[model samples]
Target: MKIERIEEYDERFEKDIIDQHGAYVINDETYAFQVLDRDTCRVTFSNRNDLNEAIEEYRFFGGHISCFVDQNGKILKEYDKVSFFDMKLEDIYVSQFYVSEEKIKRLLPYVKEFLIPVAKIDGKMVSLDGHTRMKIAQLKGISHVNCYYEEAGDYAKDFMEEAQQRGIFHVYDMPLLSKEEYEEKWHRFCDDFFEQRKAL
Candidate 1:
């Protein structure tokens, strides 16, 4: 959809989520959102046991909650991170601004989720937001991610351009891996992580 402002995008996101998972309240002064697909995600309320239990049930029943589940059927609490190489960063935003090292350092401690906003660019999924989050993830060397994406509507390009002009968005012309390549990389990364864990 065409998002003129961040608030508008957030509103649309909340509405779409509520439509799918019903309504819920946030707890712990934090919001936990689960990505459903390319266009929808739901927020998991914090203190509301009913809502949390419902989500746990959905996740237990093979729902795509985008978080890790242990063998005991419990969600592992960790910061949501994604591989920088798995993301598409070309022609999605406008500016090519540099990320501040200090900003990344400060945000790393409290990063519960790296909320990547993705949209279609020439039939390929490209990042529409979350440059800072992605950079932080890359720096921290983590896998798995908590991200959200929406399919671009007719006015997507115009909206992106407008946002870029307003300094609200930036674009990257980074090289993207093919699907096969990405899969190979993902497996390699996982293997490396496990190997390192074993060594430790």
Candidate 2:
């Protein structure tokens, strides 16, 4: 339900192993969850389909998620900051039209974990943040990416509606722009939108 720890990247030190708590593992490595219960169970994910079941278990695990570990205690992926599960890229809708090419390139190297943020809005999965990172993963031909749900406020619906009107339904519809153009366009648009809201 929340993030409490990010397992070290390939450290596997003797002091790091939580030998008693339940964790979600891929190839027998612990990726998430290290709670108070020593009797907690470990879930292995050999198939991507098992992710959903593991998520459900995480919701009820009675502890925060500890994402980062492989079956052999090697770190497979590290988000460093967020607790997220795997989600198909196609299921997430995007709100931005332009992603900075430079930013995308900088983030591409960190695509191994669920770093992009998404949220369920009106029963649909909407990209809450990290559009550039999501775009990078999509361009990398990655089918599944790591994502965490974000809690949105009342202003979110307005943002989604505006993006919808602009024909930005998915990440594919977004175009990568140079940093200068991205700032001039996207930043200007956000400023204008916020100003309009202030007037209201």
The model with the greatest TM-score is 2
- What's model 1's TM-score? 0.33
User: Global lDDT of each model?
Assistant: 0.44, 0.59
For model 1, residues 1-200, the per-residue Cα lDDT tens digits are: 11111111244345533322333333322233445342234444444444444444433322223553333435543223323324433334522234444435544655655556566654545454455566666556654445445445444565455445656453332223444564465346546756776798
**How does candidate 2 fare on TM-score?**
0.57
Q: How many residue pairs clash (N, CA or C atoms closer than 3 angstroms) in each of the candidate models, in the order given? A: 2, 5
Give the Cα error of residue 163 in candidate 1, in Å.
3.6
Residue 186 miss distance in model 1 (angstroms): 34
- Cα error of candidate 2 at position 115, Å: 1.9
lDDT of 2 by residue, 1-200 (tens): 33233222334322223322234554443344332222232333445544554555454322224343444555433223445588888888876778888766554543444456667888888877767767877787777877776676566677777788988888887888998898899889989988988999
